[model samples]
Target: MPLVFSDQDLQTHNTLGLPARAAVATLDDESAIPDLCEALSSGRETDAPLFVLGGGSNLVVAARPRRRVLRVALRGIRLWRETTTHWFVEAAAGEPWHGFVDHCLSQGWPGLENLALIPGTVGAAPVQNIGAYGLELDQRLHSVVAWDLRAGRERELRADECGFAYRDSLFKRDGAGRWLIVRVRFALPKAWAPRLDYPDLRDYPGLGSPTGGAGEIPSPRSIFDAVCDIRRRKLPDPAVQGNAGSFFKNPVIDAGQADRLRHRYPDLKAYPQADGRVKLAAGWLIEQAGWKGRRLGPVGMHERQALVLVNHGGAQSADVLALARAVRADVQARFGVDLEQEPVVLD
Candidate 1:
């Protein structure tokens, strides 16, 4: 069985630095999953609700949670297999996401360069279908190995079996306590090309011309460095000021609604999707609503990037949710668009 602790303090576990406590169990070895599952199934343990935790980068924990927290600390990485067109890499669930990306690049695997510097663990990546700079994890994922709590067995799911959408997946939608990801496999393409389609990346100085002209194409490391720099400049360091990255996901609206908003507010920043919908920038909306840098108690949206909600000092779950509600209400009343919070809330 894995090591279990009673009423573990979660302040350091989450990036937001919120104070929380719960019955915590650490699953450091894959071999212990069966025993862990059996323990839960027997109901001899506490009947409290169970929650799976990763890096805690994208989470909001309520103070004094009446739940059992399962911290997935399983760790390993390997070049799983290779094909003519792709290099398959497998990483344990507990590995830091950015470190995994950097490791792959160091080994000459370049497909995940665009997603560099993202917070969280490999196991949590597919849950949110994490994306950045014109690339989403689903695009590169090959398969996932997870322990199905319902079946009481380990299972490997193909990419297709995992319903992936914009910032959502099967694990996120239905897995919850039903599935515990053990490992993630990525199929990085060998024939790599830089994904500079995102405006910030394309317009970054010293990264060659926007037209892909005579200038030398940037390497995977160069793109990775640029992305890291951009994020650092825009988003606050969670260590310095507590935050959960972007507080809201970019809202997708119908084409008609987007057109109306754009017509009324000429400066609206909206991107057309392949589908008939349009994705409006949540930061711009929050800033326009006059909530940028505004605070309710100790929590507020970061001035540098309006999308990031920061915990200036001692902030509780109530404070975070109150600010989120206020922001969402203001944005909705102003533009008739609903802003959805990105991070998962654990009560």
Candidate 2:
């Protein structure tokens, strides 16, 4: 574990382009976890809370303390194949998520193409069950390897044990700070089955191309490419405008409630959730409430995406927060639906 202390904001993450004055630590050696835990857990002398960050893509860190906040930079990939159908691949948590997806597609594996262009690391993917375009990570996941800081030991957990849900898992539910991910593994098939029902990517003509070899699918590449295109057009480039793609997880409501809202609005759109509940697009509701592209001080909704709140340069965290609160209140008042932000807000 080679740790570095810096007073400067490391980088403007996808989060509203705010820089966190945080220290960045990297764990390159898998065997060094025990020692790393002992050092990070020695919180006896400081009031600063310890945090584990990866890719800095999912956070909004406005202030950083002097203590260690480790960012997993572990990078590697390995495959274990007992048979063509019984194989899984493992990767270090810090590996660029899309890079891994592309690698798998090159090898003809399936299950992650729909999740392409998602910003962040593989380790963080399972925590929130990162999903898009009609796909969730759990559909192909096998297990996860994380270091339990309190126990001073490493544990490999089955996918079910990780507690998968819509935009949530055990880690996200409990505000997980103690578990440090080291590596992740997934079980996928070479065959192709297109999940193109989502509107953004359904038009891809060759979406269900069959695999030539075991677990090798022709459709994954097409799907991945198409998703990237959709994301580029819909999501503002973080490098330019700086924002998380979608700020809120769509609110799930009962069909009756959904029908009532739709009947009232006459144009409000919703989709069926996996459970019996139906989901209302928060963006659509926000736009209908006339919050889209509305500005207050330096923060406002992006003109292109009703869900994304942008820091229009030199905006403070307080400004952005106020806008979010206003948007939430407006949406709730108009549609009786609540909005939840996707970024992790640091105090």
Candidate 3:
């Protein structure tokens, strides 16, 4: 059996560093999935709450688990090519996301560079359709292979079927639990040009971007390094401070509301989305609320990145959560816009 049930294991097993423990199991192999599923399902008769953990990066431990926390550990990568213009890549669900990103850059891919250094595993990406800088994981994901719990069979879902939206997907919708992602595939370009549509990219004089209609395209390495630099300067690395990257999704309101806020604030930043809703920066809103670098007890906003809520070494999960709730309430009270948290608070 690949399962381990311990009496007292170090709870530092999570990214948030919250004191949490679960009857744990690190998946041994892909074939072992069925047995594990059977075990997990049968145990639900006790009707205890069960949590499927991925990277444990974006979650906050609420109630201490009386049940098992199954750590999915599947790993590997496969590359494919249809023509000189078409290439593809497939990675196992349990692979580290940033490592996979490094692999892509090493192999000369473009779409994932802007998302470098993002914490978490591959399986978690589709849950929120992880995005950063100006690119989303959905842009590179060609399809996903999953194990359907209900039918007890595996299924392959194309990118279109993912129902991707701003920080959301079908996996997060009513279709959830029907499938557990086993492998994710990507369709990349062989003679690919880098895309530099984001402002940071535009500012770089010699950056290469196939996405841009004009500019002398540099190598993928150059683009990757530049993106890393920009991200390091902007976001807080969770290793230093406990945070799930951004604390909230950028509020997407109607154009009229955006214009209204813009005129009133005069300097409020809003980016136009394809769906006709304007995407306002949550960080900008928080900063406008004067919460930037503000500290209330151990729970406070990140000094460099206003979007992350960090624990100053000894703050409890509840402390972080209360702070988030307060910030959300403040933003809602001030702007008539409700701020939704990006991190999943298990409480």
Candidate 4:
């Protein structure tokens, strides 16, 4: 049986610095996953929740959980397979996402370069379908190894089976707490193509992207450096000021709805989706609602980026939720669109 710690303080584990606790266990490697699963199986009738915690970058623990918190500490990365078309790279759940991306880059894998500087573990990446610039984790994920908590069996889910959406996955939706991700495998193409379509990345060199043609292509390393630079400039370090990166998902509204808003505010940042919907920038809406840099008790919106909600020292879990609710309500009233939180709000 894996050693379980009682009443462990989890403030240090979570990036938001929220004080929380539960019966906790550390999964040190893939071998330990079965032992942990067996233990869970033995306690099948218990009403207590079991949560697999990764890097804790994308969660808001609003209260001390009445649950078992499994801290996934498994770590490993290697080239699993290579072919003429693609390179298969595998990483254990506990490996830091950025570190894994860096490792892939060092090994000459270029698919994850645009996703640099994302905070979380590799296992958590697919759950959130983490995306940045023009790339999403689902775009590179070949498959995932996860333990079915209820079924008491291990299973592998391919990319198509994962049900990925913008910042969402089966792990987050239907499988929430039911499947514990153990490891993830990514497919990096041998034929390299840097995605510089995102405005920040496209305009990085000051020279505009060529119209109707492939422009001066940058090396993967340069794109990685640009992404890192932009993220560092835009986002606040969690160590300096506790935050969960972007606080809200950009609202996807229909063409008519988007047009109405655009007419009202000509400066609205709206990106048209392939699905014919327009994704409105959450930060812009929040800033327009007048919440940026304004403190509400121990919480406030990040001045540099309105999308980020920060714990401005001595914040309680309720304080954070209250701030989020207030911001959401204001944005909804002002823009006629619902603002959905990006982070998982833990009970």
Q: How does each model score on lDDT?
A: 0.91, 0.76, 0.76, 0.87
Q: Model 3, range 88-194, lDDT digits (tens) per residue?
A: 88888899998998898777665677778888889889878998767888888899898776556778999999899888888776433455787898877666656
Expressed as tens digits, the lDDT of each residue in 212-310 for candidate 1 is 455788888888989999999999988898999988999999999999998999999999999989999999999999999899999999989999999
Q: Tens digit of lDDT per residue, candidate 4, span 1-347?
A: 55565678888888889888777778785676666667667884365777789999988885578767778998899898999999999999999999998888888988899999999999999999999998888889999999897787889999999999999989999745798898899999999887988999987863322332356667777778789999999999998889999989998999999999989999999999999999999999999999989989999999999999999888878999899999999998998999999888767
Question: What ranking emerges by lDDT with the best candidate at the front?
Answer: 1, 4, 2, 3
TM-score-sorted candidate list, best first? 1, 4, 3, 2
Model 2 ranges with Cα > 4 A deviation: 1-8, 13-15, 40-47, 65-67, 204-218
lDDT of 2: 0.76
User: Lowest summed-lDDT stretch of 10 residues in model 1?
Assistant: 206-215
Question: What's the lDDT of the predicted structure labeled candidate 1?
Answer: 0.91
List of clashing residue pairs for candidate 1: none
Screening candidate 2 with a backbone cut-off below 3 angstroms (N, C-alpha, C), the clashing residue pairs are 189-215, 190-215, 190-216
Using Cα atoms with residue i matched to residue i, what is each candidate's TM-score against the true structure? 0.97, 0.90, 0.90, 0.95
Candidate number with greatest lDDT = 1
Better of 1 and 4 by TM-score: 1
Clashes of 2: 3
Error of 4 at 47 (Å): 5.9
Of 1 and 3, the candidate ranking higher by TM-score: 1
